[model samples]
Target: MRPKITLALNSLLVLAFFLLLWQVLTVLLHVPAYILPGPIAVAAVVGSRFSSLAASFWITTQAAAIGLAASILVGIAISLIFAQWRWLRRLLYPYTILLQTVPIVAIAPLILMWMGSGIGSVAFIAFIVCLAPIIANTTQGLISVEENLVHLFHMHNATPAQVLFKLRLPHAMPSLFVGIRISSGIAVIGAIVGELFAGSSRVGQGGLGYSITYANAQLETNYLFALVLAATVLGFLFFFLGIFLEWYFLHQWHESRRAESGN
Candidate 1:
């Protein structure tokens, strides 16, 4: 209870301080509203257009969800492949690095060309962006299963699938959850990036990305800020969801989170 209260208070204080600074900057610089609208102005724009913004948010969320699911499937499959075949891990490890280093900005255009416009392209981009972390972490977990445990299972005549399901998957839970937490935010970013490259299918209905682009074109600084705020909120929600899941999973019997929970 005390920690939760402290966290809530800290969050409020930070938000208040930032809002104050923004308001002050707007006045001191005599900043044109087109360049940097004050927080109040941005709030007003968000309040007025919230309904339309919500619709775009729904589209963005759908893309993020689909992408995240795909990432999990691909990640687990790749992890299993690498775990079973040491030779393949050695061969494809470099390629994994290549994928990570290629830069999402450069790849988005190619994805757009291949998948065309609409949710498919966006989801594909998000999946690609989030795939590496899951693969790497889950592979580490799957491979990190205790040798003694494996020997014990083998002595019992346990099959590979049985050992994996009973022992390896349990051992992998911590690392896999870490990957999940990291991938959630990445998925959101990929979705937004995909939207930027592909643009919105319909007018008056794009994700936050479209709103930002539209705001820039019309020199509507407040609207731009509002759109950015929406995106930030979206990312925060994803991160928080990951945190909640981790708590739900790890708090039960895990030492680290159990200690944190004072259980």
Candidate 2:
């Protein structure tokens, strides 16, 4: 069998084994459903509340997607500026590190106050959470060009803009993708965290974070499990999307792609 197919089958087998063990442990220990619902119970809740779960899923996805997109555009621009100016990078890069060091939960209230408790606040929080990685990775890639290549461009008398666009950006693609992959999962977590504080106040309208809070309050463990599963799936969706983009763009020329293909 092909490697991809075999890997997928192995993953399914592991999942099956885990589910079987969980079910057996719950049944043998006579565990209460409220404390630890088995996969079967969670599945039932998922089936019964599919619509609500999907709605919440969509809300979180929108927040994460918006935040991630903004981070990519803004982060790349910042990285380019940093690459062009060493003194500015020295002045500003430490602040980016400081921002990353601060916990999102600590800053989220300020975001809510500024942005007024909506998707905007949530997306901003996500953007803050994911921005540092993109800047760090892309800046490193942009500055790490080969000395020989720099000399070649210098000998050609290439303009700064030409060198930046034609050389730095191309060389930075792999690193930017790495940052993207890291940020994709982080954006989901940030969105969910943002939703906990700033999600819609309207009845029956909110994201998975709201659903999770409600489930915990109501002691609906099975429903909570279902919501958690939905969030996990959402994170996986973003991560796989990043993976696909990386493969599509880099497969032809990148060393990583060659290694993956055993070339």
Candidate 3:
């Protein structure tokens, strides 16, 4: 409790300090609102368009969540296959990096042409962006089973299924969550980029990415910053989800997480 409270208080203090510094700098530098809106200006914009921001945020959040779910399911399946077959990992693992190296911007257009607009394409983009981390981490974890334990199982004539179900998957949880935490950020990026090519939602509705583009086009800097802040909050929310899962699953038994109290 002490550590958690200390961390939370530190985070709040840092955030407040930066916000104060930003306000002071904006005033001292005589920065125009169009160039750089201070926190007060951004906060006012947020208040004025709170409903619209909430709607857009909800849309993006749904898309990102769906994509993240798909990535987790598929990533685990793929990792299991790779771990079960050594040759397959050697043959195909190199290409996993391609998923990261390839720019989403370049492929976003192709996906748009193929799938057109809406959540389908957006979710696909996000899935592609977030899938790599899950695969890499899960595969590493699944294969990182203790050699002594593995040999003991073998010596005991334990079947592959028993060894896998009883040993490997459990051991993989820590690394899997690490990847999830990393992928949480990537998922947000994918959703926003996906929205860029997916186009605005029907009529005036769309995700924060659309709002950002629209605000920039009209030079509504304060509103743009507000939208950006909304996205930032969404990203943090997604990341906290991974943290919660890690604590839930790891706290009880994992030494790294320290006996169910805290990680």
Give the RMSD in angstroms, all C-alphas superposed, for model 2: 1.6
Q: What does candidate 1's lDDT look like per residue over 92-183, in tens digits?
A: 96787675677898889888888787888898888988888888898899999888999999999998888877888778878887888899
Could you arrange the candidates by TM-score from highest to lowest? 2, 1, 3
Note the residue pairs that clash in candidate 1.
none
* Deviating ranges (above 4 Å) for candidate 1: 260-263
**Which numbered prediction scores highest in TM-score against the true structure?**
2
**Top candidate by lDDT:** 2
Of the pair 1 and 2, which is ahead by TM-score? 2
Residue 95 CA error for candidate 1 (Å)?
1.6
lDDT of 3 by residue, 53-167 (tens): 9998998898888889899999999999898999999999999989989999899989978997888888889999999999999999999998999998899899988888788
Full-model lDDT, candidate 2: 0.92
Candidate 2, residue 109: the lDDT equals 84
- TM per candidate comes to 0.93, 0.95, 0.91
lDDT scores for all predictions? 0.84, 0.92, 0.89
List residue ranges in candidate 3 displaced over 4 A: 1-11, 25-30, 259-263
State the TM-score for model 3: 0.91
Clashes of each: 0, 0, 1
The reply for model 2, stretches above 4 Å from the true place, is 2-7, 261-263
